[model samples]
Target: MSEIPPDLRYGDSHEWVRAEDDGTVVVGISDHAQGELGDMVFIELPEPGMNYNQGEACAVIESVKAASDIYAPLSGEIVQANGELEDSPELVNSDPYGEGWLFRMIPSDPAQIDGLMNAEAYAGQLARILHEGGPINT
Candidate 1:
């Protein structure tokens, strides 16, 4: 079974978001996403000072089989990125929602997060996608 953290919000695109107490949000690909992508070999993260709109592509994770884009779940200014991923991309495969997080951003509008699916909804969406035999985007 894929490990789904109960506190994070999820995008239809399979990215996970965890809001920090400091107002920055942590972003990452979910376990189901890493499973579908296979072994991640490389990750390209956004620069710390970059800004992105909601749903905009901001990074890339390359696996042995495919390259996947990582989108911003909400409009935000990137405050930090996981530089550790460059040297140890496998963290994504092992602990995706924890130490494997991709970046941190200060949301342009925190309310945008209310529009994303919670853990239960995301799990249902994942189940529905699997039932429909659709490709799981990372």
Candidate 2:
């Protein structure tokens, strides 16, 4: 089973977001996403100062199994991108919710974060996908 941390909000396509007290939010792929993608090889991180709408493709994650776009979980201006992942993509597989985080942003509207799934909803979505044998957020 995937590690679904209760504190994070989840995107339907598999990204997770954690709101910070400073009005920024951290974003990354969930443990379930990396697990399904097999081993991480490279991640094209977004640039600081770039703006993207909710659900816009911002980065790309490549694994041994396949490559997939990492979308913006909310409309925002990217405040920072994780530089370490450029050198150590495997951090995504090793510690997904911590060191593997992809980017940070100042949301265009903080309330959009609230519209995403909570841990329980995300877990149920994953269960339904698994039971139905649907392809995970590829």
Candidate 3:
């Protein structure tokens, strides 16, 4: 089963978002995503100042199993990216929700966050994926 923390919001595409104290949102691939990816080898993150619409592909993650696009869960401009991942992509496999987080963004509309899936919804989606015997559409 995938780890779905109750505090974070999730996208059907597998991106997770955590609202930070300083008004930025931390973004990352979910545990289910990294697990399906298998031993991440590289990540192409968005630039600090770049803006993206919700549902846009903002980054790329490659692993031994497959390569996947990381989508923006909300419309926002990136504030900072995790430079550490360029040197140690395995962090995505090791701790996807914590140290492996991809980027931080200042949301264009904070209220839009409410539209994302909660932990229970995300878990149900993960369960469906597992029952189907394959990863989600990437």
Q: Which candidate is the best by TM-score?
A: 2
| C-alpha root-mean-square deviation, candidate 1 | 0.7
Q: If scored against the real structure, what TM-score would every candidate get?
A: 0.97, 0.98, 0.95
Q: Sorted on TM-score, highest at the top, how do the candidates line up?
A: 2, 1, 3
Please list all clashing residue pairs in model 1, or write none if there are none.
none
lDDT of 2 at 5: 99
Instruction: Return the clash pairs for model 3, or none.
Output: none
Query: Backbone clashes in each candidate structure, one number apiece?
Result: 0, 0, 0
TM-score of 2: 0.98
lDDT of 1 by residue, 1-138 (tens): 688889889998999999889899999999999999989999999998899999899999999999989889999899999999999999999999888999999999999999999999999998898899998766
For model 2 the local lDDT of residue 17 reads 97
- lDDT against the true structure, per candidate, is 0.92, 0.94, 0.91
lDDT of 2 by residue, 1-138 (tens): 889999999999999999999999999999999999989999999999999999999999999989899989999999999999999999999999999999999999999988999999999999999999999874
Q: Candidate 2's error at 30, in angstroms?
A: 0.6
Q: Model 2: which residue pairs collide?
A: none
Ranking by lDDT: 2, 1, 3
Error of 3 at 7 (Å): 1.1
Better of 1 and 3 by lDDT: 1
